[model samples]
Target: MTTLAEEVLAGSRLALARLLTLIENEDPQGEAALDRLFPHSGRAHWIGVTGSPGAGKSSLVNRLAQAFRRPADGSPPRTVAIVAVDPSSPFTGGALLGDRVRMRDLSGDPGVFIRSMASRGALGGLARTTPAVVQALDSAGFDIILIETVGAGQSEVEIARLAHTVLVVEAPGMGDDIQAIKAGILEIADILVLNKADLPGAENALRTLRAMLELGRPPHEETAESLPVVWRPPLVPTIATQNEGIAELLGHIQAHAAYLRQSGGWQVRDRSRLQTQLEELLQTALLKRWRSSLPEGQYQQILTDLQARRISPYQALHSLLGEPPLPQSIQRGSTALFNA
Candidate 1:
């Protein structure tokens, strides 16, 4: 009998979809399959497309998918898997799946697979199960995996930790000149895309982005001891609606990939991403173990004491951990307060 992981490895699309659903739901079977598929992972190029709402990220992803599937340079087409993370519907807890609708053209292409995911109230513009899903897609033989984040703003820079290359898309007339400085999102960009370039104020937006890049550029003096070489984010203007600049953007993506390989940054990023996943898993497991070990109603009692101001939160934590008791002064106050 062929296992689901074996089926996915053999290019079974139905098995792949079922595996992804199980992974998103955090099923144990999915984890077992992922364990088996782990060795086959890490072969795909992870590109993240992220930006504020209304920046045309979905259209950009659609165009990028097409470009990869049918390369202009006459290179053999690459298999592309797109993970579009959408804001969850509050009422139904389901993804709106707007990207699936916009990317209708790529539906019939066997070389392309698109999955839409709900954000599920997770912060940083990505769902909690995203890394696992990407891993599954990677092991399933996709050459390029594009993770399109939920419409996000400044603080949603978590994509940087996951993607080998991150494209921070922008648009004209968004007052992005100021937002660029205030928002840390631009800092993570390997490529800065000014989409909707056909719109008015496009030039101004482009110029502002260029200036920002220049300002953030690291010194590259060779004669003297210079700072480590940094990959400055290239600002590319595009009208995603028209499919213009898609080729150039694709070139930039390829260039970044090549640079990472040459500079050994590829391994660095992969290690960092793995480390993050490990730490997150460790934290979750530890919390779960700690919760299960607690005496029945002990945590609730602490919360009651905390509410009544009988014990400070720090003391409560100590009590929970079986740490040293609070000072006599504090204990007296706690008792009196509790009695009162």
Candidate 2:
């Protein structure tokens, strides 16, 4: 195991920060450390929050962190980790990293760690390295990891692949009450939050969500009788700016956690997430190997042919890939010379 990973597991915040920076920089050491640390993870409950830009996601996340950070009921203090994903600058590939600005109350709290990540033009509302970083935080002993998506949109629902409980937030006046439905975000939520509940259209938004749920969700009897036991999502209204209904929202989250445990949803979710990671890693590895092994100009000639309309794209691809292609996995950052 890397020294930085050792220190991170030993509760060294500085070492943890350094390891995260190494990951952000795409250092090999960071990947090695993550591979080592992966076994120690899987304990933290990941919560993904997604909404439109003006939906008050940051404020809600700040409030959630504060509520979790303040220990109560004889339980030991709960450590929280927040990964706030922001849009990246196209030219520089850097994020503003300003999500923490609204969370000043949590800055002095030793139990909370907030990281702002740039999307880096990755689709699906997350940085490519988000899962690894989340694993890092989980292994370092955070209790709740909040992943705030790059904002609500058609593609933003990808957070469903990463989090145990997904909160689809909406605020009145941001758009039509049915926008969540239109975007397909409502279907993916484990919990729906109507933020800025004090706004004029709050009731209308709630009604719309309720109507959608009634129309889209399966019957409660069917959910209860299902083999794995399905849990219905609850819509909780909140004024995040004033911290209203945070406790109720937390209660819903806790209930979801309990439900996941009872129904074995945790293992199922972990397996799904792992499969996704494996597929993506395999694809990347294969692409890298293909690029490195391709004869120089062979790819470009295909491109040139297509550009000159001498061949169709599919025909060009077929020519590039001969019959009986190799079936193998990546080994040590290189293509295995033999069957693997």
Cα lDDT tens digits, model 2, 226-275, are 54356788889999889899989998998899888878898999999989
Point out where model 2 deviates above 4 Å: 71-74, 222-228, 323-340
Q: What is the C-alpha lDDT profile of model 1 across 1-340, one tens digit per residue?
A: 9999999999999999999999999999999999999999999999999999999999999999999999998999999999999988778887667888889889889999999898998989999999999999999999999999988788889899999999999999888577767877889999999999999999888888898899899876432233235787899999988999999999999999987887778999999999999999999899999999999999999999999999989989999999997689988897999999
- Model 2 weakest lDDT span, ten residues long: 324-333
The C-alpha TM-scores of every prediction are 0.93, 0.90
Q: Give the Cα lDDT of each candidate.
A: 0.92, 0.86
Q: What TM-score would you give candidate 2 relative to the actual structure? A: 0.90
